[model samples]
Target: MYNGEKRRSSYLMLFIKNRIGTVLIFSVMPLILVSGIILYQFKASHYEKIHAHLGTLVKKHKQNIDSFLNEKLGDIHFIAEIYSFHELGNETFLKEKLETLQQAYGPVFVDLGVVNSHGVQVAYAGPFKLGKAVYSDADWFKEAMKREYVISDVFLGLRGLPHFIVAVRKSVNGDQWVLRATIDFAAFNDLVENIRIGETGFAFILNKEGDFQTKPLMDVIPEKGPYMDLLESDTKEEVQIVEKEDELSGNNIYVSAFLKNGDWLLVYQQKASDAFSAFTKALRVSVIIIILGSIGTIALAFVRFKNMAHHMEKAEHERRLMNEQIIETGKLAVVGELAAGVAHEINNPVAIMVEEAGWIEDLLEEEEFKESENIAEFRRALKQINTQGKRCKEITQKLLSFARKTDSKIQEVQINELIEEIITLSAQRAKFSNVTIGCQLQDGLPVIQGAHTELQQVLLNLINNALDAMEKGGGTIDIKTRLNKDHIVVEIADNGPGIASANLKRIFEPFFTTKPVGKGTGLGLSICYGIMKRLGGDIEVQSVIDKGTIFRINIPLKKYIGEKQDLIM
Candidate 1:
């Protein structure tokens, strides 16, 4: 009979927890969540679309640059062949031929030179020395000799001007000779510098190894040397990568490309923020609408529930009691679900703040580094630290806010802050377990209106799972966040012992812990999933055994806070 009573109590608890009536109890909150989710989905979709669009544009631009260079090189090669046949190695003959050719192709072929088999300057048509200059040791000379005809990579030449070489090798009277022409690099730079496809959008180019091949910002000068030795080695013509902070925008950028030059990794890139500016503006407008709508919905819901309860006193009293208990249970479930993640999330900000503080102290002490070239760099580093530290604070605050309540509440929250915290805490955890953590946070994030507690719960669950999957050791967790059109995203990832392919589909099921008996309840993730779904957000996990795992959560920002009284009641 005692066992039977225990079973009955457990069934009742389960029923109360899962009953659809719970939705009614949390109707207004759910409505707000749904509205926020719609906004989030719209925003996410917009970002994907914008990124895709920018990627396509960059690729097309890269192709154009490649085509332009190839066409120009082809023309120069034909001109060089004509000169070779004409015996232009003779100074007098070369001078006369150049004068005639200049008139016909002045814009395209500004200067021509006849180089001997050893790549030494033999005859020149331009104002430069005809016999004194030597090109034997030059990359263009070496490359041309190796190939019948080759376009040299961009480099600063004898004129101290950025140029690329188009050279063709010819066997004249059983002697090898190189016919070469120089094309101004500035010509290509000017072609794409000011062209914009959207607001604040301007395109730039990068070499295959992700270095700026053309003039980037006013301050990003290429290092004094060969271009990282990468341009000449990379055979892939179709790869692109976003530029990290340098002299440009003081932030990272979205870069794309089409492999147009086999010998060059030419790609075009644009600022992602600029490309998605329109969508972000639209998202903000939507947030304002949702804020107003959420208030109205809440008021209507309060009035309806109040009236219905007043008319059905007994049922209302019982329902209210049951709801209070369920809410308490849900709150506990959320806490349990988020235990490991909260540890990691909070630990992150604490760690970063500590590191930044230490750096600040170090900067104050290091007068030499401060006075030298490191000054500007140190200042920038500090700025980034503060920026990132504040972000961490915001995330922790959000988590604390969420953990304090069972119902929804809107507040000004920064998504990057939350993600940063997760990154910090998870990184520490990963470090202890021989796992590394990575973060990719976006800049210039806007404040949002949403339930902080729910978001925190989502973050916590995802992070903790990553920690556990590593079993004994050797794993990595990556946490990142970005602004979609109208929503914010947080992604948690891990490289640990992964879930079996078969178990992957069942991981989210309630009470499905795969651990040994008495180790886990499996309700943690399910409850987290429910909270996110209720909040109009979502949590998804992907993993592979002996490999790793990744979890992504998408949530809407709270645009406004309605009257305090209508919250959770």
Candidate 2:
């Protein structure tokens, strides 16, 4: 039994799995798979585009910076080669040169000075009073004496402001003199800071030793951004990209390139999410589409599955109806066989007994019994035997006729006679169950047009139910037939343990029963309800707890149907 149940369950589960599972596998799964594939490819391509664009920007800005530094250095070199020490040593002459350079390049040339090989300012022109400022221990001065010309990192020299200069060394009469020009710090800082892209993108310059050549907008860590690494490396690659995570700013993209002959690194830093924000947005949209598509697919699948299940349920109901029809056909056949069996089994014996009783009567008429003391009693007994035998034959004929009424042929139904016939039919069961069947059928009741077999069935079912109701403790069942306003009415009432109000209203509903498991099928009253409705009649019930119940059926002579019901208090 368990194995059979398991097999049935597995088949049902397999059916269910195929319903929605196959839909999702074929529709939504492929959508998700394709979307994932496309998104992955887009991610790779977008990252490459972002890196390439940032790298190009960093490289181009680095070139501009290199050109700016070289241009300023070139200006100093031209001045040193054109003017001699004695000519440039004059403060008036040095001032005129600074004015000319500044006029040509805006305020980029802050000041001009000629420094000696010993790091002493010989002549200073433009801005700040530093006529004899000594710079023997200064890094720019020391580096300048070694190289032919030098571009310095930002420093707070004599002016105590962040500034750098381009300078060239000249030798005169075995004495070394340097021509130096200060470039505006703000202009150079603008040069790097202007390399902005998104909100968090900015640029700054870092010298070989990890010092800022220009002021960056935000405080930056050279180690975190790997500025120090790029600066210290001897890698000939001019431009390189790296990504790192920072404690304060999350992940950042770093693009670095060599600047000013590898003396400084032009590094651009930006938040990674901000740099690839476009790609992230696209990814979110893709995910949303996949989600919405999945929802739509599942919803459609559910609708389709529900439609299929509904059709299956409807088909099953139809199949059950067909099976019930078959069962009803079998029941009619069995009833017919029962009727035949009763006639064959009981009628012949009854006829034989009647014939034997007559033979005894003939024997009583003989001379031997002429002077019998119980002659009158014997005649009366034989008469009663003959009457009972005929009555038995009448009952057998009634049963046979009732059983043969299996067809649904419409005809004029005599309500009074039909009620009498059903009462007679139920008399035996009523006697057996100790139930008294009584009727107050009115005479000359107007006949109604209906199915005779069905009307008979309705009356028989009601009387039999009354018998069953009073089976346990015998009670009375009263059946009444009357005529009112061209309609014939029949009311069946029983005085057994009464039906509760809750059950009274539902007694006509199919599959509602108060009888024990094997005693009732619960379809009798329901069938009666349907029959009366088609016969242009109404059936109503009234019951009180612990009292009795009345089922009143009304039938009309007109060939129309209406649901008119009235409960008699």
Candidate 3:
């Protein structure tokens, strides 16, 4: 499209496309930009609030669970530090202490056990019948011996029931011993389970090894979730929120926080669609509105630009017509100047020739040969020269009169007098073309107020066009003037081949030509039409194909049109 080497592109289509693009850029850019910015801010604020709220909930739950475990461990350590190992080793005394603890803390302290340095439960109280149960090689005993205090992940221990321990180790007289207690699994499980949120939200705990420590609300695979990723990522954030697509469930949201001094994780899981449902709905509605608004903007720009282009084309056409009219006016002015010059130059020669012929006739009538034989012939020849020179003088006078008033000053005009001047101007061309120009004038016609040069030009153009049409063969151009009611009417009819019905309608339209190339500019009748209309008059035409054409001009009377008295010049 850039280069016109092989084939040319239609630049009009290019212009239209360019305009459409320009309009869309200016119009739609702001709409999309503002909408996108607003939506982005809304999404950011909404997501920040969600993450903050979930983090707060998870942190609170973590604190309560840690406090519960620490309190239980402190209780056991208090008993170990207060009474001697000998006192705790008595079965009856251990039973009494366990009863006191259960009375204070409810069933959260299920059972108490006293284990010796040799991994044997020296004393047991309540619940199971383990008065003589051995504690060697047990996992809790092994873990309890290593640390001063421990809260372990839930495990099915010797009783074949889900349970975990809060154990405290003490050294007395060079002997190491663990005072351990069993915490109720149902009571600890309630802490994690109660952290539910929306429809698909639930909280659970996982150890460092990706194994569940508390029962979850729904079935979960520990190996295949974003919580596992959060667990391994080792980020320092207190609460981590992640959204990921799941193979079977579409999208899921996971919020995680480290629990139990970074030994386990408290993770809350929910569907992402459920977490930010309000934002999603708002986004959908905004998108719909923007789409509809964009369509409307494009349609409006298209129509507006198309209208502007159409008006521009029409204005260009009118400008060309005006330019042509200016050229026609300049041509008429030059022709009038040339006509006046020729008339002045020819007038002197004809006057001199007429005087010289009279001088010769005077000499022939006088002199020494009053009875000479060639005197009659010479007198006849002198008479002939005198007649032709007088005719030439009259023609030049007519030309000077027509050329003198070529200005557009308003003055009173006699319609018959203008027609007579036009007939005299076109008389020679009519004779050469074998055409005759005839005029029918009625005297005492009322004067019309108009421009003299413009009226003369209109009549002269009609007569000359008639002469051209009949140039191929002889024809008659009849001119008539009359007072028709409240107006003055002039009719110029030609007995030449008339205009076709098709061309007759558009005879007064500018630049609409049916003539051969260079023979016509087609502005004659259009200028005439404009002139008549500007003078508060009208020009009309009627024609048959083979008969003749008649052009009529009507000028409104000044008195009838409520104007001042007509100025007679």
lDDT (Cα) of model 1: 0.63
Q: For each candidate in the order shown, give its overall lDDT on alpha carbons.
A: 0.63, 0.81, 0.79
Please give the lDDT score at residue 174 for candidate 1.
Answer: 83
**How close is every model to the real structure, measured as TM-score?**
0.44, 0.64, 0.54
lDDT of 1 at 235: 34
What's the CA error at residue 182 for candidate 2, in Å?
1.6
What TM-score quantifies how close candidate 3 is to the native fold? 0.54
Clashes of each: 16, 0, 0
* TM-score order of candidates, top first: 2, 3, 1
lDDT of 3 at 136: 67
Model 2 misses residue 272 by how many Å?
2.8
Query: What's the distance in Å from true for residue 415, model 2?
Result: 16
Instruction: Report lDDT (Cα) of residue 382, candidate 1.
Output: 71
Clashing pairs in 3: none
C-alpha positional error of residue 511 in candidate 1 after TM-score superposition, expressed in Å: 69
What would the per-residue lDDT of candidate 2 be over residues 1-569, giving only the tens digit for each residue? Answer: 34534764565556556877888899999999999999899989999999999999999999999998998999889999999998998999999999999889989999999988888888999879987999889888898899988999999888889999788988999889999999999998889989999999999998888988888888897766577777777777778888988798899898999988888888899999999999889989999999999989888887777767667756875686466545644554454456546755899999999999999999998998989999999999999999989977865654444333323667787888888788888888999999988889898877778788888878888788777778899999988888888677788999877777557545665546887874565657766765665566777776655577788898887865433321100
Q: What would the per-residue lDDT of candidate 1 be over residues 1-569, giving only the tens digit for each residue?
A: 34534764565545444542554447646666776788688778987776667667667766677777777667666766666645777778866766765566554555678888776787777766546488889987887778777777667778776777777888779888877776656666776775566544555555555556567533433442223333444435354445455454544454545344444444333455566677667777777876676666656655565555445554654576466545645664555346435734676767778686667857656766656766667676777777767665654544333333345665667777876765676666767777676777778888766667666666776777777777487666777778877667777777777777456555655546788865665656665765565555656665655567777776666443334331222
